[model samples]
Target: MSTPQDINVRQKPAVAATGGGTSTILATKQLTKNFGGLTAVDGVDFSVAEGEIRCLIGPNGAGKSTLLELITGQLAPSDGAIYFDGEDLTGLDTHKRIDTGISVKFQSPHVYENLTVEENLRVPLQRTDRDVDRVLAETLDRTALSEKAETGASELSHGEKQRLEIGMAVTLDPKLMLLDEPVAGMSVDETDDVADLIRSLHDDGMTFVVVEHDMEFVRRISERVTVLNQGEIFRQGPIEEIEADEDVRRIYLGENA
Candidate 1:
């Protein structure tokens, strides 16, 4: 199993003027995904810099999830290429991707409902050679779940369960974490809490690519935004720039926004 040390993750990198880092950690060229006659993701080129939090948003069926699936190797791309940390991830399986410091927290909480919080962390740790006790402690504290260490996941609040799921991914000390609708179905306060946690983790040098719908959460979590439409990149830049576009407001944000 590979670890963060194996890849030499460059932390605290100098971010570019437009919210991108000097180094490109992940990139896809002409990436496309199709299901027979329906092309969900058209030919697209995307990139993410190291130590950056990138948000992907669009109206329904804009291919946000499909693009994420391609990166995680959940679904193979019909065309184009995906490169990560200077390695080709085309044929690599999801487990291999995790070994290379790529972990994901899907849209829903995926905790072991029957298990305790500490036990849930242990499952992912089984893949790593790190000290179990130390990781469990750190993950609990970082996720603000220390008090619930012995609590069953099914008993935790919705937000706490989300945190636990995120902690499960962070236990491996991944380099990049892909989150899909991480703040879904949460109160404003809970959503804010998740955003703060992500920012705190980013401060610790973990990169993130988040697929979210809540614009407020997106503004709070990411400086750069990528808007996809019709399986293609409609626009990408500073959050304010994307938000201020008239076409974007008219099409996705609507007149009231």
Candidate 2:
């Protein structure tokens, strides 16, 4: 794990094309996680600048999800520290992290099938100082799900469910958002729509760290990317630089070109 001082010394200023604001919002120091004898995340260090849509790309079992879980407190790291908004969060619980404006959306939609779209959103709405009705209205409008707000979660198409999950994340007005494979199984059109939604959110000043396997989608949304392999960072740089690197291509992209 690297310290803030280490990041400042080694990491160049993140490029500005992706709308990353010039302030650091989240920082990690020598973050490590282990599950019994299995070391899932090994001393990873990174910083997410304010308003940047940073993407984490890696092969399966590369520890991307584990890193997210550690940051969100779904799992505690065996060592290292996490700092968000200038406060130490390495010791906080998941809900506590949420309360501090860190929200995570899993790959699978977690909405309640029994609940209406409006009701599904109400769960997170109940946690903030923001007015629930106002947040709900904004979320519905943003996701274009107003018409389906009264529809049950189970009634939604796969795309709609994905949008709803994003809407729920939006309603929280988080300082940092972790999206895990947000368009995992959507059609091409649906993938495009979700990509647009993510771009819009970034434009609206939201910071995001997305874990995705969709290279094209990642290229569309991320200005900078971090590659993780076998639990450690393999590369970190602007998208074009990463894409053109032979090592990155061999390890993650393969001959898919």
Candidate 3:
């Protein structure tokens, strides 16, 4: 697949870049999430640059999902704040967050099992004031689901279902996509196809923060990697730095390490 423009993943000086300049699409300041006494996510500061693909990885119960939940407004943060495109999002509801151009494709392919692929894409597109017919056609081609337009979602393979669900989100033209375990059960070829889809979309200026466990897939698509451990960031840098760190390797070995 083709590569995107070279990205400088290093931290940038905050010069009030809103949709331009450094282009940090999303950021969290001392973000935290707690369930009673258990702190699932500590005061974590995370950010993703626009037109970049960032991979979030770590061992089980590493607060990956919690952090995503906080960003997506699935779970309210116990502390800290969330910023998207220079607007405060910590208080917005889930739908409001979506309205601000943040779309999420959770681990499950939550497509309408009974609906055809085209119908499924139409559901989200029709909800907005966008030109449904025009965007639907574009989403089909962008998601590689053009041939499956008339196919029932239940009749599709796992990979196709994944693409359909992703297309559902793409219909509304989201600025940043947070994907959770996008290739959990796919075959080798299917995983590669998803990687290529992401790369193509990234080249077109879509930003992504993908939470995945597949190391091979992560390395293939990620310009930057963040390793979370026990609700705190353990490592953050290029994939090569994350891979070469002995501490990060041991952390993945087990949570207790």
User: What value does the lDDT take at residue 186 in candidate 3?
Assistant: 99
Candidate 3 segments whose C-alpha is farther than 4 A from its true place: 1-22, 253-257
Assess each prediction's global lDDT (C-alpha) against the native.
0.88, 0.87, 0.87
- TM-score of predicted structure 2: 0.89
Q: After superposition, how far is residue 53 of candidate 2 from its true place, in Å?
A: 0.6
| Order by TM-score, highest first | 1, 3, 2
Cα deviation of 225 in candidate 2 (Å)? 0.2
Q: Which residue window of length 10 is worst by lDDT in model 3?
A: 5-14
Give the per-residue lDDT of model 2 (tens digit) for 18-74: 123437888777889988898888988878888899999989999999999888998
Between candidates 1 and 2, the one scoring higher on lDDT is 1
Best by lDDT: 1
Error of 1 at 121 (Å): 0.6
TM-score of each: 0.90, 0.89, 0.90
Best of the two (2, 3) by lDDT:
3
The reply for model 1, stretches above 4 Å from the true place, is 1-22
lDDT per residue, candidate 1, 1-257, as tens digits?
Answer: 66776443322121121123338888887899999998999998888888999999998999999999999999999998787876767668989988988999999899999999999999999988999999999989988999999999999999999999999999999989999999999999989889999999999999999999999999998979999998999999999999999878876787654
Candidate 3, residues 106-218: lDDT per residue as tens digits?
Answer: 99899999999999999987669998889988989988888989999999999999988888988878999899999999999999989998898888889999999999999
